[model samples]
Target: MHLHPQKSLYDLAQQHHLEGLTLPSLLALTKEQEGYSIDKAKRFLAFQGRINNEMLNHQVIIQNPYTAWFEQGDQNPAQIKAFIIQFSVFSNQFLIAQLHKMIHADTLESMHASKEILANEIGVRFQSGQQHENLNNQSSTEGSIDGSRFSFSAAHFEWLYIIAKKLGLSFAEIGQPKHGTHATLFFCNELIRLYGGDNYQISQAASYAVENWAAAGFWKQLIQGLQKYNDQTGLDLPLGFFIWHDKLEAQHAAHTQEELEELYFTQNLDEDAFIQNGNEMLAGVAAFWDGLEVQRQELATTH
Candidate 1:
């Protein structure tokens, strides 16, 4: 969905009478941004919880005394997207997978190892002349969805949709902003094609990412500020689940968080209560992923 004019950072901060950097200005925005309440009533109450903490926690900095998200009240869709990409690149979960530090993030230690995966992935290099096919293959070897491949427990799929929809976005709309996740994936794929990085290869690399980005076109470039992060985090994320997660949504009843944990996380729970609990329809979500296996294999092999 397009962002509302009012949601622009500059616009929002301006609404609160904040247009410059100062303690009063910062204090005012904390009341507005973190003070934002989608479900809560009485904006004043919202301010009380997160406002002071943002400053105390150093989550909101005053360096250079700039006010972009706070004063400008606007973020070009591209800037908002760039923020996600740049920040996510540093995520431990994403990097661990790239470095092959560990298969996936299940434990806190491995998860912590991933904290700098992006920084490392970007700066760390494969030893020259030491690059082995096996190492690159290790990256490719980590299990991936066959376009038809579907292995997530149905409970997982249900969780994504419930979180996404409840947050007022379709799962389809989550990460496709400026350099959306897919765009990043395409860029990596393109760079691999230009493995030598010669002049000729440079053009091809740009060409490849540009083509994919072009195909996605308008909406990809015009992403608005985030609507809800529920789609990005706070839900079970199986790698590349975005591609097939939506397929399960049409098949399940609407769900809430409690039901999802009960079904997937709990040792035992009644299936019927899922409706009240806001879990995905387990049968359909499971079937959808499992059903995609043949197709997934075909896509993986051909692509």
Candidate 2:
């Protein structure tokens, strides 16, 4: 029952000579030895509540003037193109963060869970939610998982690229890191450092924070703007990418709730450290949006 700063559940089990135990066994052992308390559960729930509230009210997405402008419609094509380019840069680098999460996972179950997410990112569909069986499959080489083929066409970035192309953007324009604004590049790098790094607690908290951010309805906001732009300009922007993310992020809300419970209840968390990392990750997210806002303003003045 001894707590070690920043150590994972697996690390704690190994420290207590309880190695090789499954997640359920480890949780039972920890709860039995520590004497489960309702007060502790309440505190965990309160912590989660705070994180959710923070994301819901985060100024970066909720209060950002750019989001309002975009939602209102009739956006300049240049501004829209700029948004796509920077977002695509961020999206393309996200797969590396997922791989890092899988590699740094503290348990087999966590690793497999991370792999499932990576598989989905790269366009691997699961039948009956049976993704664990193909966690070992090489997805990078068009591998098949449970009869679902890994296809470049299905990748999330490819979806973004398709949208970008409809806006007359070329591959070099959307895919290159050199085109990202300072804030955009900084945000992508922060994802690697916090979400993809070796610190399991920090990574978990960052990932959880991001899922909450996505669930806060930014995708819908963007879609509103895009739909308006299409109506005003008579240009058909394929919105399937944003629409798909809106649906997926809604589902991620539940997934993140389960992740938080499993992480907080089973692991010996450095609560303050976890909160700090989540805040830091959100700051990066804010910066990315703020950069886009800057561009939007500049375009507004010119137009």
Error of 2 at 129 (Å): 7.4
TM-score of each: 0.17, 0.79
**Candidate 2 local lDDT, residue 95:** 81
The deviation in Å at residue 108 for candidate 1 is: 12
Cα distance off (Å), candidate 2, residue 197: 1.2
Tell me the TM-score of model 2.
Answer: 0.79
Candidate that would win on TM-score: 2
lDDT of each: 0.30, 0.75
Give a tens-digit lDDT track for model 2, residues 134-166.
Answer: 222313322234466677766778888888988
